[model samples]
Target: MSVVASMGRKEKAQGAEPSIAPLIELAGPDMERVNALILDMAGSNADMIPEIARHLIDSGGKRLRPLLTLAAAKAFGYEGDNHVKLAASVEFMHTATLLHDDVVDESEMRRGKLSARMLWGNQASVLVGDYLLGQAFRMMVEVGSLDALRVLSDAAAVIAEGEVMQLAAAKNIETEEAAYLRVINAKTAALFAAACEVGPIIAGSAPEMRAAYSAYGTNLGLAFQLVDDALDYGGSSMTLGKRVGDDFREGKVTLPVVLAIRAGDARERAFWKRTIEDGAIEDGDLDRAIGLLRAHGAIAETVSRAKAYGEAAVAALSATPAGPYRDALVGVVAFCVSRVS
Candidate 1:
């Protein structure tokens, strides 16, 4: 059975699945300003910059990262306009990374559409990503909060490091779970942590509160990525925004593959080495890979781990005040993990 189908109906009905609508409703006004700022900043004298940038920007992503920034700030009673700027900066940073990532992964689709790299070419995609990064920094400086800038800049550096680490680990069947976690922590969770932390920083919240938001974002990001990894082998293309098995096709060593390799017999090990380590995937290979992942319960275990991270993310929010904002942030974590359930 599919992952979602495997879940008990009682679990699904008991709020095991949640909506981000609460977070969206709570941050409505600020998100409007953030959306406007994003559009304004995406503009440029050079036509191609905006063209390439808007193509991806216009694609219908949930804008969850920037919303996290806005919610964290509003949760702490921040009243300044700087939160808007920081929200835009977070989004630009995210968009820039997606642009670069598509190129790095040689991905052809994003958000159910052709990727920027597929249409604009890798050179243009990379350059426009650089442009977005420049704009992200400019907005960060405009905020004039050194703490926010430092957090975001540090995340940018760490994201680059994560990409490099993933590149090195790619197609290596021996990649351990700890090494995989490190890669995702850097590439995905770093930005999420920074995005949530900057809000509390700009609000001048207590150090403990700031740390709480950072931890929440970090755990939420881990859950989000883990779900994505599981969905790649178990979900539909529409839900994935790309083909299922794309990770397998690319020879990526995600958690499911790692676990399967550990539990697999000697003959199965040869199959993985031939397809992943050797990059010799043939027809019917993706089906075989998925079958093995299911046989070993790797996908189920990956989802279980994601649920643990989601629970940790919700726990981190206990440090924040109990209100609609905190409830909504908790909802965000549930929404992320629910994709698999």
Candidate 2:
């Protein structure tokens, strides 16, 4: 049977939320190596560099991106140690992005703790993020796969572009869904695509398999981000790892806001304008925003869109040979979209 077909049966039988534990288990030994490489590479004579990097790295994130890199490599029967290097590179890239994002977003919390910027200051955070990026590139070069390096390097540039795109789109109530998607595709999905693509590239797999992994990563990323957009308003602090309504407070024009704006009346539009566009949020504004999101079904719609992307991600896995690794990857899609459930 196909991987997706098997996944469906398992879901039906289990009738429970899908878990990432399987992927974690499959990647455990390699992940131990990846973690060591990360710590070793993050070290420097300038103690603050490792300090800042480790602060975020030690935070309780699931490390999903690097796991994807490792899982993708193993899925295609690769046995080389280069996958470990690539996985660590992917993680460093992700960690650097998070550090920079906290600085850009001016966020005070990450992974249920104080942000690196909050503790170390923005300059330290940014510089350390740059340091990590440099380290990530060095690791990529050590892998000796020009194709993998090119994919990851291109993703780095795209992630920067996406951040810029998001910055421009911030507080623009008129930002359409397409424009928002473009920002995420560059900022978030680009790295995911590169992380998964490197697996096939290192494995010397066919172009078709590489394309499949890229598609899976891209759709998974889109789904993941869309769920985050929904969770910002509708989820708990425990689930979000930050205070609820952070996006609304920060005037982030996520999909829920865009959809809410589209469906709102003139008075509602003015509310969005005053709060999101003009940065005039006041007491109870977040509650009002959540109410409007629910009233207009924006949150539900966002989750629905996320589910569509999750299905697309599962579909992309059809090209790969079926096994425990593929099954775990498919379960990951369910786990991502199931957060709102």
Which candidate's lDDT is highest?
A: 2
Candidate 1 per-residue C-alpha lDDT over 1-341 given as tens digits, one digit per residue, 9 for 90 to 100: 12223333434667555678989999999999999999899999989999998899888888999999999998999999999999999999999999999999999899989999999899999999999999999999999999999999999999999999999999999999999999999999999999999999999999999999999999999989999999999999988888999899888999999999999999999999999999898999999999999999999999999988888888888868888898888778767877887
Q: Write down the worst ten-residue block by lDDT for model 1.
A: 1-10
Report clash pairs, candidate 1. none
lDDT per model, in order?
0.91, 0.92
Among the numbered candidates, top TM-score falls to 2
Estimate the TM-score of every prediction: 0.95, 0.97
Task: Give the alpha carbon lDDT tens digit for every residue of 1-341 in model 2.
Answer: 14334555577688765789999999999999999999999999999999988888888889999999999999999999999999999999999999999999999999899999999899999999999999999999998989999999999999999999999999999999999999999988899889999998998999999999999999999989999999999999988889999998888999999999999999999999999899998999999999999999999999888888888999999878899999899899878876885
What's the true lDDT of residue 217 in model 2? 98
lDDT of 1 at 27: 93
